[model samples]
Target chain A: MIRFLSILFILVSNTIFSILEIEILKGSDNLSKVAFVPFGNESGIEENYGSQISKNIEKNMLLFGEFENLAVNEMLSYPSSENDFYYRDWKVLGVDYSVIGKVNSVNALGNLNISYSLFNINRRIKILEGEIVGSEDNIEDISKIISNRIYEQITGLRGIFDTKLAYVINSDADTYQMCISDIDGKNEQILFTSKAPIMSPDWSPDRKKIAYVSFENGLAEIFIQDLQSGERDSIQALGMTNSAPVWSPDGKSLALVVSFSGNPDIFLYSIRNKRLVRLTNHYGIDTEPSWSPDSKKIIFTSDRSGSPQLYEISTKSKRKKRLTRDGNYNARGRYFPDGKSIFFVHGNNGNFQIAIKKLSSRYIETLTSTSLDESPTISPNGNIIIYATKDGSNGYLGGITLDGKARFSLPVKNGSVREPAWSPLLN
Target chain B: MNKVLTSLNTFFLILLFLSLIFSMFSFPKLNIDETQSIKVNFYELIQQNDILFDPPAANTLIKKEAKKTSAINEKTNADETSIISKFKINKLDIKNEITKIKLSKEREDILRVSAIIQQRISSIWIKPNSLSESLIAKVLINLAPSGEILNFSLIEPSSNTSFNESILTAMNKMTFFEEVLSLERKLFEKNFRNFNLVFKSSGEIE
Candidate 1:
């Protein structure tokens, strides 16, 4: 009996410890790792847009959430052609792909002879290359197309750099401004500014209107602003705390945190009826409601379980189930665009980082190590996450793909930036 | 007595270690008779562009019209066929050019293009399982070198308005020959552009 017990224990432990093979979409999740060397400026032009071109391409790649970018700071050598390409050096650095280009002018038209070739770092061979010409104004555009072409050659996804993001920039405590910016956080234009505190600006499913909580009335109110007309209207809500306005997948309703019955809850307001239907009812603060892609269920932060954790409630059944177990604080979770899992902030050891939990298995994985990481928003493709981080005293936005690589920070000019909601890809 | 217990414990540990080694080294029998098989289409492995254009019904119509005109010309002699035949061909070519021009010019109108473009691309996607209430298929399509749809596939699944099967069905029936703009076929082939089709079934016809 003793021998049998010993053997049984060993078998059980071994079976339990077997490595789980994660079935990932092999080519589907790959982004070409391209390095745009500071484009060699052979021509003494008054301005060199070659570097700008590379940066633009990088921004486009990042926006598409398709390609993993090799940090220029980490590149071993500047290689733009097959001869200069030391694939061994790049492979040693764990890079999977590389891009090199040179920019020069032939005449006054500001002709740029940009020769770039992509290479597979692992196989150590050039994948694709071509020379293109562009004026100074069109260099960035030309570079974007080249980056996209290279992206398609490797990962086969459309480049998203050409896409834009709609967000609300809080100019001051009273002045809440709705704005749209390039994915790199440039070319920001205020669509509409409100004297009230704007909270939770969400992109319309079509990327046109911004639904947000505006406080122009001294009380929290939800407003939807059309990007074109700068026109605004109050979204239908009967209760207080009508914040956390999220557009449903249909764009016909708004899933929001409302508290008309004296307790904050998640409610759905129909755009047609302008009527209210409560989805969650609890005395605890039930806020930060996000709609699943199906609009049949919602994932929101609720304190009904004695602590703030993520909960999923069906819109039809109203059946509630707790989704987080490991963390004492898990709030502000957003469903992946695929709706298979949720990415949220998990507080462990008094530090908050992004954690993902599958809906079916409840398996939890922590993806961020930085403290004070909040508002975890997945890209439109559901392949990466962008969230706010406090790099020391200043809050900056950083992003990491689903596999936990290609970590980079968005440059902030003035004060800290927070609450980045990845907009739907603008056609 | 204590020594005896210690010896027994050592023997147990040794047995445990041996068992672990045996299990690690052994290969379990995966009997053909006992194992069942199910087909799994690994969509994730294929990196196809997600360009979701409606079917090429319009292009088909254009081709049909061209064939019909060519047939009529075959039956008629050069003398019977006045310059009208020549003008008709030119008219058709000009119309094709205009369609291309309209598609590119209309690209700037995001809302209009999205609505109309979706209407033209009408393939329906059925949910594979019952547990799924509905699936939203966002298809991204790449244009072929010939200005026709090269390929298109769905994006994320959303049960909301994004998943309406009726819209997809309607789109599948459309030929966006009307949407194409006049661009050099070479230029079209060299660049990548995406237009989305939002398929939702309100069950109410628009």
Candidate 2:
């Protein structure tokens, strides 16, 4: 018994002392390379829909410059099925992932079936595969579905290709138009056109309507425009000025700014009963109120401390806490998707730029270098930020990935584009 | 009586365990004759010549015993103090030399290979963004002697799904480590055959 016990004890101790451990703290700064091969087709489609669908998916995946793609000419072979797909080909090209698909025949309902697969070359395994069915004419929608799946599988982030953006465009000195379009700046729709100025456009949580400040009525008023019906309604807020309307997470109320006798303070307006509740009653100027993701607190810009700084107020207790102190002008603060950090416009040495600050830390990080960058809007995934920047006296929308690795701008509109609001993702 | 026997047995068991651990890891022991030592008293040797020339003392037994001690002095022929003064050896210096020359050579091999493996993983791991919460995930890797990765498992996972997926994706991209081929076969089996990788997101906290 004694000898047996000693052996067991020695074995346990040896296992504990023999293992090795390594610590890794850094990650690659390079974007992953993806190869999108031209899909195959069964005997039913005529217009070469396979290539068109693959091309659209490729464009969507590379829209934000988060990934690198292998050119079609660089590919050695076009593999549409698993049998034809070979990992050796992609590995030689240094491609990390390969995407292939085949367009099946139309069904009885005239819906085309497309099957897609994504493979991790090094692991030699099919990471994702699925079939999507849609109308024959809606090929773009089907490609979006497939791209979303591939993106989700690879990056573990929600697919954001189908999301839209809302911004105000000024075509002329007098004409101000409210517009909503796809994130790629396609499928543009003019919701409201007025002779007065339009500002502070926001999307409701449900994404069925948009709430923005339109000055067409000779006073600053907030209007909710229905996307499908092109109908607009004003939420008769009790004030001389009601602007900066941001929807709460629950889609039940709006955290807006109201100026009562030149005192601009934040208020919450109920969309159903048109009731207004005072959230901030300070004599100082307070505006640009935005709700946290949890709807428990509202962060806004206030000059209560002798300068425009960011502050958050609890909804239930009405208790306020100062958020920013490093800069003299820190305003328009919005919580990140995760609610751990906040990004806002920070003015340093007379130059205004976009800056981010963690709630638990005191240091602030500047993201943009160009002065006059304002109205910064973050994607739902919190991976990208698009702000209004000016080039040669013309305002345009500029975007950058959160990692600071990629910077790109939206296609220049004929009019000056300002105040870009990213729409919420549809469930 | 029963309690005393059990206690005595446990004491012997503990002593045996301690001795076993020391023998396995400590330096080799040398066989030296510790019982016989040369004791050279400089004061007595200098006085012995003077006393021999002088008259005999009244206590003759004491004088004879002193003479006998002087005759048995083995170090009388050489100056032991001068020899030691010429070559002074620090007690701590020997211990330090043993660790520097004997232990560091083995440690240097593992350090060089571990750094290369760490850098390779860092070059392929595309960390996800906006992970504000500090997270740690551990992955266990098993490698063959040919420097090829045999298997890996996420033994520990963070609360964030995206963070965990990023680590797995990077690991899947690495197929061979080849740097391990330069390591000795014994060292490879002892340290690199199976190892744990601790990935930290807090290193890039903004």
Candidate 3:
């Protein structure tokens, strides 16, 4: 009986916990495998500067979702200089590229010098080498700079790690806060709070100020707040809803939506003259104005063609042209980095998701598979798009590459987050 | 009763021993001459690059060469006309020999090496995530004669990094191929020394 029972138990356990064979599909094809060796600390400082910088660079690379970094534990050797490097070691480990560095004390002014080198392991050649001198507080910034240089060298595109993101979180019916955070959603600083709704936060081209729609006085108003001074100025819509402010590329004027003429229309507000110029006089709802990259035209959502669709109007000629034809509900269209395509919220068959359309080819590509995906904002480099999505009862922010290859979600702990605006690449 | 049982057992043991001796001598031997002739025919077909052609054509070519050789052997003291014919046939045979020696061996070697490489690479290749079937990456591999990979470079990289990395990893996993060592040095140098492999998830070789 004991033998029979043991056999029965083994069979049940084997059936219940059968090994799962997951099919590994292909990963991104162009990603270079890079390993960051811990920099040597000849300075004798207590802080682990080498590990810290390496970790920071690794984090930035992971966030970019392009290059694959070798885990420190997988590294067989940590070579900080050319003499210590063994070509066969990294090659055997399948590392295509590697970065090595050393930190040393430069002077009595508490300045430290960092020398770093990047090598292509497969080709066994040195690609880049540089040195920087800075105090301890500047280490993080210096690391980010190094990351940007590496990213540019590998991808041939400028890195946007130093950029920021502005978004709004609705805590309750009566509480709302507009927050600004780093591109990776760190260092979140609450810029403003209001009992009424705060929506459609946009950054100026110069990154000095943010313009957003605020309902603090029980009426929709547009406010331009200086990020450094904590000062703000508002423009009253005069008993009409005014929202969806977008900055032109030149930072000279803002194109916004105002319903002052008894219907929603696009209006341009000039900072130099402090005057509003009405651009569209359509009877249907005209809102969500986004400027073209060249600043010569503005694309806005208009229901004049029966259902809401994207339409572009020239800032000079004031002539209008319809941009979207396929979807019955297309709105919130913003120009992609190249200005050839526009990313927007697309709605069909009770599902709202993000989509992109190329203007020249009239080619539309649906980006998100999830329902209720809104607030699609393209990254500065145009490689990624972040949007608001709902999973079950909770609303969170989700990001996806432009090719729909990689996806990630950033969920707020307790509140619903929405209206994500990816800031321009900051210095 | 014990005596009778021992006698019966001895009779059966004698029968088994006789059968074993008889079976050993009766085992058929493989015809060595037939196998040699078949090998010669195969080599002749390969030399003519006629392995892929109709069998009758190869047979005809063999018969023709045999008839010519016999004619030359039998007509050693023939007249002027027949001697001239023999000279022309000999010249043609020499040209055929040169062409066969130059082209057929190298072509066959190239085909064999390509087949071995494709099989080895496909066996170990693991596809990366988020790659479409349409995506392809061209990889150039430098290898020693023993099939030890010296270096790998992406000559035409795909837009997806994971796909390229997976191919490179697969190449690395197969540190060396034992099959490659059997190839001739000239063949290895002409074709297998440095080669480009186009990798796709479909596992189809073009």
Candidate 4:
């Protein structure tokens, strides 16, 4: 009888336990605050490299306005090692996470060893710890590596602090220079200078070379320039005019616009055998072709629907599907990093702005309110988009985070900048 | 000896049957009675707009009136059929008014406490946005009667590792719901002692 009573009691308890469950779907509007503490310097180092490295990382993490920072004066205590760290020090300041490190001298030959650790204040656990060994000359590079690791650990997304950007700079009306630089506008290098217009600079998959359209021969022709050797080679596709060259993900082909005689169409040119295959045959103009992340389909703009609209074509099945319908001008569609959505220049009421649309949905959401935005390029992590916009007749690069929480502009160049292209992440 | 063993087995079976019948009837009595439910319907049908906002003395007056009516019904003892029926109806009306206040008060407490728990979790959970995949996970939380969180387990994990990790990190940051202390002992044990929190991702770009 006692055993039978226990079985009945278990059944009765199970029913009561299953009755209540609460679902949480919304998140807080507040951003996570991170505290970057200045590292303790070794006795022999004279450069103050400890604070310099921490300052650089702080700037990089706050570049996209992704997180808030703690003021140095507000810190109750500055601890440089795991033994001295305390969760109560940051918890009282409402900090979500804290980063601390120490600088050590490896030897008398000026080599430095830096050890860092990241902690979650609320959970009271050490999340990450690492050490980097580099010379004083590579302090900037070492800072970038540490920033990437901390950012990835916090957000679970790939770190893109090392990616580069390629664009065109027209110092004068006639002199056009194609330039590449670090994403933060550092290490600016001019790849080529021409007396004609330069457009559509795209980095190859391996990032060793860049393919761009140059009119140096008094005609729109595509050229691939090697960064290390400074060598230039043309695609040499038989066409009267060619422009807008975008590399395929495999680095074996280029999706470009070619007008054989008069009509502009989309074609895939193989780089190995120099073979050109026609992908689109239409009386209407087709241009600005970009490969999907999966390389299975190519998204382009065409006038077949009476106005410029976005359409995608399957490379395998050759089937076509229209992506935008509400506005007449939806041009230069490029897929997000995941290939599940696309962003393009949306024109409504004569205002050209950056907008995104999921391939599975019909509605479009605009990200920017600028009137003359174009040539939007997404970061490798798909968290931000930078596009070219007009600032009182001088074209400059404007950027906005996909979350719509930040708006920023790149450093102004000596001339008008146009056609910003974001490079892929380094392996 | 075999006959005696068979008889003993039959006796045990009969005892088990009686226990099952007892457990089935006890649950509803502990939860809600039919009289209380009927009173709740009457209260909602008439006084739902006002809720429990009436003066406290009104409830006491109703109790006195109900007792007076019952006293009259007993004194009449079938001598006045119409009078007795009228008193019985008045008594029932008074009983319903009281239960209406009781049930709605308990329900209001439940709703208020549930909202606080949801808001607390949402504030602390640093949601990492993949912005590409739609996913959901469920976490079962166990809390002590003093409103301290005893344990939590991820019963249903999402396909994205980051999403699951964020949820677990958020749960670890919390040590107590403490708001449960304001709830009645029975309510806390029934609803919050062991409950599941369903976390969902909306796939918004933000």
Candidate 5:
């Protein structure tokens, strides 16, 4: 009896100790609105450093989905110093956050002082501030670095502005080639050429390799290409009609849809064990499999339930559950960065709009009203999705914040762009 | 000699059993009382302040108003004046109808608050009972800013932590705030700044 009581006390103490774990603070659902005034480079440098910094910060803030950067023209007042900050001016504009920075010379040392701070307009508090020392030539590089630091301090996710995006650009009507560009759609580097239609280019978890379904050999084949080496090889499989190769979170396997068994089904190929584990064995099409953050489950669109809807399957237990129930076309589902919800393309009345499904309650909210919004790729921060939409005569890659704000288009020169895959943050 | 030795062993065993029995009752009784005392302190503090628990209903209305249409919520807290001096005793019936409408609207607002808070709390790790003082101000301002969270880096992250799990947990847990929505107009839709949330320990749990 004494021993029993001792065990009971130990268990109760353990429970109490466990209950005292740290509790996380919940912020508002409303994303932060920040205005980045172009950095003033007073050193008479040829490059407009302020404009560049503003652009860089804008791209980073947009990618995180948590921030909305106020347009330069929209800001009512410009405050450079503490005296310039009028809280009422910001209050009238409904501006929640404001950022101001300057680039100044540091004597004969040729070092530059880049000082910036993030201010909370609503609370009238400066949330973040820092200064960096860099050479004049390194201002562009320094701006990128500071932008990342500021981004992480606010969004709690690494910024992907410094990361590159690989997309297919229509160089001409007959030429659809794969090109890699900065996240802002700059510094375009053509990686591969395929007038035969290159589709579905996905970044590996580590951002080292790109797995894309290329139609080079007159058939759809999943090719894993080394970004640094430019060496490419196809994943060896039984038959053709394999596409949409999504890398596992561990980067040890690829979850893809293969039609080798005469019907499209989800298949997992292990890079280590060299074994293929077939997950979905249905007659209906099971395509576009995205790995959950845990890498234990794969969510894909299947018509197994009479209409196209999103379904999730456990990689270990092989158990499957339906995620979307609303529409006849709910396909190309991707997991949010936190793995709490899934975002997919929902079609109704012949229009495809972006929709998100809360995994626990299966509540679906249609986000986009624009038709032909195909191939939604969420940023690493899970704040926004960059997808392809038809803009009049051509196609453009545009991004919309998860909260459904103003959509911005990535400038693709004279060509219709599609299948935009936002890369993970580059280390 | 054998009889004496057996008696000695029996005496030792009896003493050990008695000690164990006494400790089993005494130690837990002391510890449980201490924990209970801490909780009682929290309750007393809340009662003294007169701050409501912010029921789930208010949380939901706030969320819908923030998400669906910004116009519907711009004119909040407008009808709180008493109709005392304007010969309004004859118009009491009309006033009662208006009060009923206002009460329902207030209830709806409470429902909205409840919904938003429910989802927010589920994600974040807010300390029990200490939320009103420790987190309410910062969270309300940061979330109600009408924009996405930005510049959310950590200060003095532990050198031992490789993944920065605490920071990630804090960011994921926050979904919305009540104060950010109360501000007028939707001016800055883009940029956001991070708020450093610090927790303080109260004397006891309520």
Candidate 6:
């Protein structure tokens, strides 16, 4: 019995130590090569602050799939400042860009200051240099800020590294939890836990609140909760099914699906006046409403034409038009950042996959070749997409670029993760 | 002119009569028997009939005309030889022109060089995520005689820094191109020394 118990304990510990890992199934050949040297640090510091920062930056950069980072061992020299940098050394290593930094204690009260610089090895010029001063506990946040700066300066697009992700994890058959984590699935915190199933978690544009569906009252109801204070507010559904709440781009209103009229229809809920207006009165199901970037239109899925298809309705004029026509089943469509195209789930035969269609044309590009892929959410940069897919019997989150050149999977251990909603870039 | 013509006719007739008398005398030296008398009677009858012959002056004119015709033919032969030589020279000139055209048409080397550059750049280029399919960046490159990249610059920037940087990186990766060394110095300098390359995500260079 002792031997059996020890073996069981080892197995359990091993499983617990194995966290969700990102698997790069495909990579683009045109990625820029970058190197991150271990930051210089003084002794007697409790933590390896510089190393942590570099690692965090590396992880965040890799999530975009457009950068190939060099490992620490591959670096020929560690230069924390311009005086130590030799462009020829990095050039000989075939590195296009290099990043170096130094960490030092600012005061006796445990405050720290980090100075970093990004260099373009080919041009032999320093592209960016800055410093961040904060407490030790905020090291991760500071590193992400550095990453955002570098990404913006290099790519000419705002970085989503400082953004967050809200998802639902089904712990068991009857237990579900709404969780929030960093964009790379780190520093996760459970926002709300319930014995009943939770579905369709959405983030407010302000990033301070999250609106999601909870079944704690024995029926589906929408609740908006403050992320910091943990306070909740529910819309009055009046004994009807309410779900799939998406915040408007301006954060003044929400488009939700309610079944009070004996059928699921889209309704606009004004947060200021507490007024509810029904946008669609079709007898078929209308759900998954996504707001346009301009907040002038709402794209939602409706089955009024005998199959699930996407439709766009103006918020003011209440005009409606069908958007998708090729497939028999199309749903969960969201506008890209540019608002010129949309990402949606398309069904073909028995397989459902993620696809993108241009708003002004009939061209539709199916992004994922995997079956049963759904709920695609585009990154704020409009370059990458995160969606939920199934592998064998487990559900995992997958990401792919708009061009289908890079692909990766993030598989959660011990449970199934779904309904991934990528928050907007937080100010 | 009429008197001259008559005198020339009489001279030809006198010559013909003399030749006939000579031919009859030269026929036999009186060796004929009774049969020879019959032969002589036949000849006397022919002479009595007075068969007319061409005058010597007319024969002389015919001989002079034949000599003049032969001289004209010889002159024409010389002219024909000169014309044939001229034709041969023209044929040689045409052959030279054809060879010049053939040399100009054998310019597959330029295409081969472009293909080499395209293949090398595509293998090293990593397209930036922020770039769209429609975006194109025009880059200018300067090369030395030894296929070394002397300088690289972007003529028209795409305003997307990452995309431009990627193009630059690709160019830098191809530091030396050995294929350019095989080209003639003049051809290389005229065409490949300094040129513009249009970069697109489709891996096509314009």
iRMSD of prediction 6: 14.0
Better of 1 and 2 by DockQ: 2
Error of 1 at A223 (Å): 1.0
lDDT of 4 by residue, B1-206 (tens): 99999999999999999999976664322223565656555455335324234435544555555566777545444433333343344456567667778778888887888899999999878788545788899999999998899999999999887788778878977899999999889888878898889998887665
Task: Say which candidate scores most in DockQ.
Answer: 2
**C-alpha positional error of residue A92 in candidate 5 after TM-score superposition, expressed in Å:** 7.3
The deviation in Å at residue A298 for candidate 1 is 1.4
Candidate 4, overall lDDT? 0.86
Error of 1 at A116 (Å): 6.2
Report the candidate with higher DockQ, 5 versus 6.
6
Q: What is the CAPRI rating of model 4's predicted complex?
A: acceptable
lDDT (tens digit, per residue) of candidate 1 on A1-427: 9999999999998755532111111111233355666666665756766678777777666663445677888888876456766767776675656777766455666566677777655445576778888776676668767876775555433445555665555545556666678676777877777776666778888988888777788778888888788888987577765889898998998888787766888888888889888888788989999999988889989888899998889999999988888868999989877687788999988899998776765467788878899877776756667888887876778888655535777767355566777788655
TM per prediction: 0.54, 0.83, 0.68, 0.83, 0.60, 0.78
Q: Please say which candidate is ahead in lDDT: 3 or 4.
A: 4
Model 5 misplacement above 4 A: A1-95, A104-111, A135-138, A152-158, B1-206
Which scores greater on TM-score, model 4 or model 6? 4
- DockQ of candidate 4 relative to the true structure: 0.44
Clashes of each: 25, 0, 15, 0, 60, 6
Q: In candidate 6, which residue pairs get closer than 3 Å at backbone N, Cα or C atoms, i.e. clash? A: A30-B125, A30-B126, A30-B127, A31-B126, B12-B55, B12-B56
Tell me the tens digit of each residue's lDDT in model 4 across A1-427.
Answer: 9999999998988875465778888776667899999988878777788898898888888877778999988999989899999899998898988999888875576678999999988778899999999888888788889999998988888888889999999999999999999888999999999999999999998889999999999999999999899899988998899899999999999999999878899999999999999899999999999999999999999999899999999987889998999788999899998999999999999999999998998999999988999999999998889999998899999998776767889999999999999999999
Q: DockQ scores for all the models shown?
A: 0.01, 0.45, 0.02, 0.44, 0.02, 0.08
Cα lDDT tens digits for candidate 6, A1-427 = 9999999999998755532211111213666789988888766767788888888888888885768888889888898888999999899888988999988665677788889999988777898999888888888888889899988877777888888889988878877889988888888999999999888898998899999999899888999999889999988854288899999998998899988756889998888887889998888889999999999999999999999999999988999999999879999999988787888999999899998887877867788989999888888888888999988977889999776667988647457888999998877
For model 4, what is the alpha-carbon lDDT of residue B122? 96
Total backbone clashes of model 1? Answer: 25
True contacts kept of each: 0.00, 0.78, 0.01, 0.65, 0.00, 0.20
lDDT of 5 at A24: 32
Model 2: residues with Cα > 4 Å off, grouped in runs: A1-18, A107-110, B1-92, B101-109, B144-146, B180-190, B203-206
Using alpha carbons, what is the TM-score of model 1? 0.54
Better-scoring candidate (TM-score), 1 or 4: 4
